[model samples]
Target: MSKVLQFACHFFAVCVSSNTPTAVYLGIMKHNGVPVDADLMKSRQQEAEQQMQRIRNEIIMLIGDVEIGANCGTKAFEDYLYQTLKLPVMKVTASNKEAADDASMIMLKEWCDANRPELSSLFTLVQECRKWSKIKSTYIDGYLKYLNSATGRIHPDFFALSTETGRMNCKTPKAQNLPRKSNDPIRVRNFIKAPEDHLILSLDFSQIELRVGAFYCRDRTMMETYKNGGDIHAATTSVIFSCTYEEAQDKHRKEYKEQRTIVKNVNFGTFYGLFPKGLQSTLKFKAGVEKSVDECEAIIRNLKSGYSALTTWQEETKRDAAGKMYIETWLGRRRYLSNIRSENWGLKSFAERCALNTPIQVTAADILKLAIVRILEGLPSRPWLKPILQIHDELTFIIPKEKLNEAVIFIRECMEQQPFPEFDLPLVAEASAGESFGNLEELEG
Candidate 1:
């Protein structure tokens, strides 16, 4: 690529990190005459994910189904896919040498050739997919590195105020408001701080979803796993598939999407309702209606057996939510689910989603708020540590090398030991000290 193109691509990646769809849309509109059918075009973006999955399945099925008495041309094709589309998120085929496991290379070439006019768009989309699957975590690392830099100190341009909402807003990279890492880095995160010696202590739960499931469902098994820092997803898998914990763990080994979907089905099913077909789809119901249907029933039966509380909670929550026609955080952050009572089917569905999501999200968000306040007040003894940034569950701080350990312990205490109902559930944390604040992978040893 030309220097200009390279620079523009880099710039575009930065824009994606900002996570503002408007700016992205405007940029696209400026470069191209506003491609029509934007909604359709946007939805077709699903094609990227579906296409990737399809290509992957084709390759996997080929390897599993082919009557390979001898490995011939097929091996070469598998090798090509491995090297070309090195998706870190995906599991690689066992053959590392001159053999390709799947037909991704051919599929990719076909996809690219068929969408030549929109190759740039596809490339952008694919890059984004890879980031979520690959690089976004690194971006988080890099952000932490900057926040921890020796010379780095608090910058005044960090926070802003909205005249419209009369709320404090974050400016610049909007550290306080950086977009969730998705298709692009979105933008630079906005953070505030005292100085290098000062640090921000951040703590979040290791298995919050499990805790939520435990609390909402009153499931002893879920609660106990979280209590002991055991693998909740694997446990769920064990029950749903009627397998041992080891087998459940094996199923999840390289099948994260499948594992995640199944876990989510059971998790959310307790909160809502997981009919068989729905569970199957969540559990990666690919191509086979009968299989998915069968799998879902098994999933439901297992979930009900293990965590019937969730099923009851889901119904109770639904009834409570629907009747209220809205929900609120513990601190009264209300989400008006007017659609729960709406005449429109689409709006009602959206409202129901909001209704279900509102309590869980709002509760978690409030917990974050309470933790922040506690950390700020409790950390005065270690003035070397100052709050630099807050990104959902993660917080950033810049600290002198000497004070980091002490500061971290104190922060963890404040962050993790909030007085929720299940205080003895055993809070688990995964923390790493770092030199700077840019990428998480670069955390201090």
Candidate 2:
């Protein structure tokens, strides 16, 4: 009746496809109620094109300069070639695009390897342009075209139990993948709005994954940070950079800011089992610290030393999963990883990472599912409240103006209730409400 252990069978039941919990919620909420700002999306699409064009022009100009006898080696020339020119590390070999544009044939990773320090900015720009371009094409134009002209609604099909980690999947318009809190100009989230008499209330778990990780690993410093209501990133920064906790508190300080960013990358990435190469790319692109592979390895070594228990715990989990050839969430949801015993090194590593990450992520998903079930069961009593969208760690609802305060209280209570006995620590959720989905302000308790 609980459907907890049913995931193993449900995963392979390809013949049975019908309305899931998410789909039922979607039907009840009715996408027609969500307002789409067509003009705004079109403007965003245009701006995205302009931004891509500008970045392309800048890259083309830089490439033209590099085309004129740029030496591949030497620190001085490498600095000029990779850093200054922002050229990707490329192999001098025949390529399919050589006949069209010689520059197009250059491998991004190979070029970056040759010139990591200098190409971060260039790579960032390229990545930004490509990301925005895709956002424009997919969400802005593609999704917009799919919108019902009469209702201005897009009904994206939702797969409730699609992912092994128990995450929801969306297709057709891909509602789940819409940009939420990015600097992208074309944010599709802007289109989903509440009706005239209602407001969109969003409740999101605050650092749920990290909190779960700390609980599982039993890392004292991390536990203390949570226990004392201190900033996790700041605490980590102080530990990593050898700065006083007071010093780390100053977010404006350049050193403190960089340390905080590094700690964030380390915190989120470690649970997902990041390697030095992955860390290097994150450092260079996201944190803007262009370190070589060797430097990245050293940083990783230091981080592992600092948080050895987490590393050890992850390794142990991976080994256990490799041996068992499957893993389960804390709430008994199973992920039968057939590839865990794979001979292929890449497949083996992937399975290992899945082993390490699945428990935490899957448990988080289970909690959310429980919370949703609770909310839905309770919603029958309160006819004014309607669940709308569920982002990864956040749930959104549309409620009447009069019931806003009551809905907020109900949501907060439901989410923080801790449905699983394994969770000893209190779950913290941040709630916000706004006239529309995109524009939300925190509701201070």
Candidate 3:
């Protein structure tokens, strides 16, 4: 057997090329897998085809498994699930009485609750299906009546979140919420099933936002809280209030929530040039304590002081972006921000948002991708654990009824020391393994 020639460990750089439409696609692919020169990729059609093939090969190698290929991309995945799950497809007849037949809107609830098994995705979706079915059908019909019929199936077209952005969201078999956001037992998740012999493994980080917050802040004081195993929001409260971490704890945690929300608000405001009026209208002030102008200014100062790295990040990236439309993440993910240069005020605000959000969002995405790759390789030859789903930063893997401790320890180890070498300050990964995603987060009574 021949060894697979693999490439890993890439440091990102700002690549500048003459403005052209197709050149950018080649540049991105070059970043992900093959290092195809944009000029060369665009220069020849045959070379471009070969480059794409190389991309396919690299992704397969990177993931270290073939199950992902079973339902390749979105369309392929939708087809596989719809056929395999055989979710009921029904439309309301707009009549006072419900009619039964092939044309009847597939009773999503019935299919999910009865037909679905003990899978995380299935459990989540089934509940949503039931809710949608229970809702007055009159509302559903009225909403759909105004729309065109070109939308053939509900699942594929319904799952789509946004057309402009590549990001797509999904409602369950019943048109409810996106799969990740839905908290049903039988709707969207019912579509996902475990292999007869294999178990599904699920792993998610606790307070990932806090961890990222500490990383970007670079505040020795703030970083020390995370390292010392103190609650992050509470720690922030302590720092702001000059109180102990224990003293900072509150039932409502209003003070802590305010600090955290301030950090986010100012982090957002830095790019958008937040207005004072907009600043006061946040969820943080739901109790009717309007953030005064002085308070908003203080929040901005504290935020800049906190995420010093991001301040530098914005300045450097904007300098790098210039008039261009994109900025790259830590792992070379380039998010376009051309709107920054737009004459329209709305677009300009969004462009600024992209500037702030691109790095954090893309860097988070990169970290997730790297973690997944390493986890795949780190699995033991006959490891009982198996990868099931990668919904955002959370990874759901099935575990055996026995080997729970071992699996939890191993899953923790995978994220802690991953992507080779060592991570400074120790990349702490807080995890809980259990029967289900919801169950994993639960504290024993």
> Would you estimate the TM-scores of all the predictions?
0.54, 0.78, 0.51
**Per-residue lDDT of candidate 2, residues 1-445 (tens digit):** 4565466556434213222454566566555344566777778878877877777676556544443211122244345554775564543325421121223222454456565645445545555555666777778887787777787666666567788787766677666676646555654676777778888889999898888888878777778788788888877666666777888899778776567777888778878888988898788766767668986677677667777778888888888887888986665556778888889988888888888888889777767766776676687799888776777988888788888889989998988897667677668889999886777899997
Badly placed stretches (over 4 Å) of model 1 are: 1-171, 176-202, 250-305, 328-333, 421-424, 438-445
TM-score pick, better of 1 and 2 = 2
Q: What is the C-alpha RMSD of each candidate to the true structure, in Å?
A: 17.0, 7.0, 19.5
Q: Clash pairs of candidate 2?
A: 83-118, 88-111, 89-111
Task: Report the lDDT tens digits of candidate 3 across residue range 1-445.
Answer: 2222221122212112111211332222222221112222123334324444554455445333433331133333323334554544433334633232221322343355566543234323323333333321212332233232342212112211132222222222222232333433222333233334433445655555445534544557556766787666665555444566676676466565656555454433444335555666553333334567767666555555654664675566566665667765544445667676889987876677667555555445445445544565565553666553445456556556566567767666766654323223455555554443333443221
**Residue 158 deviation, candidate 2, in Å?**
1.5
Which regions of candidate 2 deviate over 4 angstroms? 1-23, 26-33, 43-132, 180-182
Span of ten consecutive residues with least summed lDDT in model 3 = 12-21
User: Model 1 over residues 60-111: C-alpha lDDT tens digits?
Assistant: 3534443221222344433433454442213334554442222332234445
Stretches > 4 Å off in candidate 3: 1-201, 209-217, 238-246, 250-297, 305-312, 323-325, 378-380, 418-423, 441-445
Best by lDDT: 2
Q: Please give the distance, in angstroms, between residue 226's alpha carbon in candidate 2 and its true position after superposition.
A: 2.1
lDDT of 1: 0.48
Residue 279's C-alpha lDDT in candidate 2? 90
Q: Which structure among the candidates has the greatest TM-score? A: 2
